[model samples]
Target: MTIAAPTADFLVLPPRPDSTADLLAASARQRGMAVELLSGPVLPDRLRHATGAHLRGGPVFAGAVAEDLDLVLLEPDDDWLTRLPYEYTHRDITLTTLGEARWSRTPMFVKPPRDKSLTACVYADGSRLPGDADHPADTPVLVSEIVTFLVEYRLFVLDGTVHAASRYATHGRLDPAPLDACPHRAAVLDFAAGLLDTCGDSLPSAVVVDVGLASDADRGTEHWAVVEANMAWFSTSYAADPDRVLDVVLRAAGPRDRLAVRDRAFVRPHAAVG
Candidate 1:
C-alpha cells in the first residue's frame, strides 16, 4: 500500500531569516515535502490552512496560534506556555541581596526566566549576592534550588514514542551523548511518560522533557527529578545526536505517511495575559 506524506504549515514571525522556524521549514522543503510558510501574527486567516505549526514568535503571538491550531510546536516550556508542578516562578522580582533562599535550602541559581542561552549566576552558601537586580542586566532573575546532580538527560517524545533521548553535563553545560547506557535512563523515560500523561491529549506536537539526578545526601541514593520542560521546535539538540533529533522532528512533522493527531480542545479563544 502506498503511504501519504504529511502536510506541514508553519506560523512564523516576520522576516524569518536565520531562525529556527526558517531552518526547519527549509529542511522540510529540501526533502520535497509539502510545507506552507505564514508570517506575521497568528490570525484565523493564517492558521486556517495549516495542519501543523512551528511556533517561534513572542508569547502573545505564539499563544494566539496555539489557541487556534491543532498542533503547535514550541521551545522551552516556560511559565508563559504552562505551569509545571511545584515550580514557583516570580517574574519582575529581583533579588537585591541574596540572604539565603529559604526554599532552596542550599545554594541557589539565578537566571533569566525566558532566554537561557547564556551562563547563569551560581551562589554558594554565604556568598554575597549581586549588589542589586540592576547588576545582572535587566532580565528578570529566577532563584531556584541548587540541585546537586550526577547526570542530566533530555527526552523528546513525538506521537507517544520516545523519539530522541540523550545525556548532558549536569553543570548547565551542553554535551551530547546517547543515553541508552545511562543508569538513570529508565527513570528519565518514566518521568517523560508521566508528564505526557498529565498533559493528556492537549500536549504539543513537539515537547522536550529535562530530567536530572538529584543528590540524596542522607540516603546515599540518587533520585531523578524534573529539571525543566521545553518546546522541541525552538530547543537546540545541544549534545543530542543531531541526525536522530532531526529525524524525530521531521517524522513528527508528518513523515512516512503518518498524520499526527492533536486535540481540538487544546485550541482556545485568545485571552490577554494578565
Candidate 2:
C-alpha cells in the first residue's frame, strides 16, 4: 500500500545509515501514510510535502524540518519537562545548572538534555571535565542525583500518552532483554501515566521518557522514577512495539511552524568559540 513518491508525504532523514531509521521509513510506506525520503536537518525541497522526519543531531530542526507542525524539541534545561517529574513523581530527581556546578568537587552524572554532541558521563568535578568535552560553562546540563536501578525502559510518549515501551538496560549494564516478560511492565506503565497526566501543556506532541526501577530498595515497596527525557527523533527505539513507536516518531520528527530556537550550547566548534 505504499504511496507513489509524487503523492506521498515526505520524511526527512539524516544522510547516515541506521536500521532503526530504515524500519521506521518502511513502516510508514507500508501504511500508505508516507512516501519519498528527504535528507535534512537542512531545508528540503517541497517542504509542503513533508509529513515527518528524523533530522540530523545538530541543528534543532523546527523550521529546517518543516513549517507546519508546531514541534518544539526539548533539552536538559527545559522547565516544562523538568516540572513534570519534579512535581509528580516521588522519585528523587532534580535539574541543576551546569555553571553553578562548575566549581563543585563532586562527581555528577552530567549530560546535555537533548543534544548528544555535549557527551553525557560522570564527571569527577566540573574542573575535571575533559578538554575534549568542550561546551560553554553556562550550559544548562542535567546533573542528576545518582540513583541506581535494576532495570530501565524507554517509552514513546505522545500528548501525554504512553504509546510504546522497551527495556534497554539493567543493573547498570546494557541489557537488551525483551519487555514481554518484564515484571516491572505494569509498574513502569503506571508510573508513566501518572507523570503524563501532570504534564499540563508542557509535554510535546511526541517524545521519549526513560524510567528506572530501584531494586535495591526494601521488598514490595520498590520505586519508579524517571531517568530522563529525550528527543524522539534521535532516540533509540530499543524494543518497544515498532508500529506504536512509528506513530510517535512521525509526529515527534515531523515538520513544525515554531521558529526553530537552537544553539551550540555544548562543546561548540573549536574554530568559532574554541
Candidate 3:
C-alpha cells in the first residue's frame, strides 16, 4: 500500500518577529508547508483550534495544546548517561536514580538528567544537594566529573545524519566558535560521528546533541566527549544553517501523535521536569 505524505501545518509564534522561530516558519513556507500564524506570543489555550503547532521551549505534552495537536517536547532520559559512550573511562560521569543519589558522600557536579529544573553546579557535598530547596528530594540527576571544555558545539541530528551544527561556546564561556574556519572542525566532526554511531537506533529520531572537546595534555590530544542532549524545540540555533535546523526542530518539537506517536512522552516536572 502506498502511503501519502502528511501535510505539515506549522504554528509559529516566534519570541520576536525576526527570531529563529520566525526563520523556521519562513523556511517551512518556502518548502510548501502550511503555516498558521499565532499573531504574537499567545497562550496554549489558543492552540485549541490549531493542529501541529510549534512553540519554542513550550512546556509539557498535555492540556489544550495536547488535545488539538500531539505535542512532543524531547528531553533527556535517566539512562542517557549509559546510552552514549565512555562513562568513568576517561571521564567520571554517572547517572543515579533519585532514590540512590541520597547515599552519596563525595562533592560532585549535580545536574538533572534532562532539564534545568534545578541549577547544575558542583555541590560541595553530595549528601546535601542544593536543589533540595527547589527540586524534589528524589528526582534523578546526572552526577558528573567536572572538566573544562575548550570548545562546545550543538548538532541537530535527523535520521542518522547531522543536518546542522554550530559552535556555541569556548573555555566555559559564551564565545561563539566559528564553524566556517574552525581549525578543529574536522576532528570535532569525526569524534561526533563516532559518538552518533555508538548511539545508533538508541537516540530519538530527531534531537539535538551537545558535544565538547577538552584538552588532555597526557594523551597529547584534544579529547572529545558528549556534553549532553537537548530538545530541538528549545535549543538555540547558534551559527548553524537555520533552514536545515528548522527542518529537524519541526520533527523534534511538533505535535507528537501526528506521525510518530510511539515517541510521544509528556514533559513533566517531577521535581519540576522538562
Candidate 4:
C-alpha cells in the first residue's frame, strides 16, 4: 500500500545563514514535504500559518510561541530540567572570594548553568578554579565529577517517541551509524523518558538527550550517565546522519490530510518604536 503524505504545517526558522535549521528544511523539501522558511525574527506574519515551529535562537519568545502553536521545537526547558536531582557534584563560592575544594574524589568539570556558549573548563585538580575577578557572570557554576567516559550518545525524542539515536566520539563528533548495539542505549532511553515525564508540558515537542558512559576501572564495565540535554532544533546533528534526522521529522507529520492551525499572534519586540 502506498503511504499518504502528512498535512502538518511545518515552520522552519533559520535564524542565520548556513544554520542547521536551513539544512533540515532542505532535507525535508527533498522528500516532497512543504516547509516554510522564516528568514529572520519570528514576526506575526511569519507565524500566521505555523502549526509547528523549529526554533534555533534564544527562548526569549518561546512562551509567546508556545501560547499559540501545537509544538514549538527548541532546547529543553532549562528552568524545569535543572531542578531535577542528578549526580551534579558542585562547589559553592561567595561573590567576594573564589575558592575550590577537593570535595569530589574524581576529576571534575566546570560549566555555567545559564550560559551554554561558554566553553566548559575541565580541571584535573581543584587548584585551577578561576578567581572572582575572572568569573564571567554571577550565574551559578556546576562542578561535576568526571567519569572515564568511553563514548557519547545523542538520542532525539519527538512527541514521546524515540525517533532518532546516534553515538558520538569523545570530542562531540557524530557517528554515522546507530549505536543500538551499545549497552548504554537502554539507560539513555530511560533517562530521556523520565525527563520527558517530569517536564513534558514545558519541554519542546522535540529535544535531544545526551548520554555518556564511563569505563569502570576494576570491572572493566561501562557505567551510563546522563551527560546533558539540549534542544533538538538547536543542537547540531554533530556527526549524526542527516538523512536519518530528517526521517524523524517526516514520520512525525505522517500522511498529510488536514493542516493543523494555531490561532495566536507572535510578536517580535522592538528595542524602541520609531
Query: How many residue pairs clash per model?
Result: 4, 4, 4, 7
TM-score of 4: 0.57
Estimate the TM-score of every prediction. Answer: 0.53, 0.75, 0.77, 0.57
Instruction: In model 3, state the lDDT of residue 173.
Output: 80
Q: Pick the candidate with the highest lDDT.
A: 3
- Please, what are the lDDT tens digits per residue for candidate 4 over residues 1-274? 5333225545445345345556677776776656654444444543544444433334433333433443423334334334544542112211111243333344567665333533566676655655455463444555655555567877776666567787776644445446576666687677667656764555445556666766657776765655665655445665455656665443322222322222011112222100
The C-alpha stretches of model 4 lying farther than 4 A from their native spots are: 1-8, 15-19, 30-53, 56-74, 77-107, 113-115, 124-136, 171-176, 180-205, 218-221, 239-274
User: Which regions of candidate 2 deviate over 4 angstroms?
Assistant: 1-5, 33-77, 85-97, 131-133, 215-221, 257-274
Query: Model 3, which residues run further than 4 Å from truth?
Result: 1-8, 14-19, 25-46, 60-64, 87-89, 97-105, 131-133, 217-221, 261-274
- Against the unseen true structure, what C-alpha lDDT does each candidate score? 0.51, 0.60, 0.65, 0.50
Q: Candidate 3, residues 75-160: lDDT per residue as tens digits? A: 55666765555731257777775446666777777777666566777766666765455666667788877666788888888876
- lDDT score, candidate 1: 0.51
The runs of at least 3 residues in candidate 1 whose Cα sits more than 4 Å from the true structure, single-residue gaps closed, are: 1-30, 34-77, 80-106, 117-119, 124-141, 159-161, 170-173, 181-183, 199-203, 239-274
TM-score attained by model 3:
0.77
TM-score, predicted candidate 2 vs. hidden true structure:
0.75
lDDT of 3 at 157: 87
Ranking by lDDT: 3, 2, 1, 4
* Candidate 3: C-alpha lDDT: 0.65
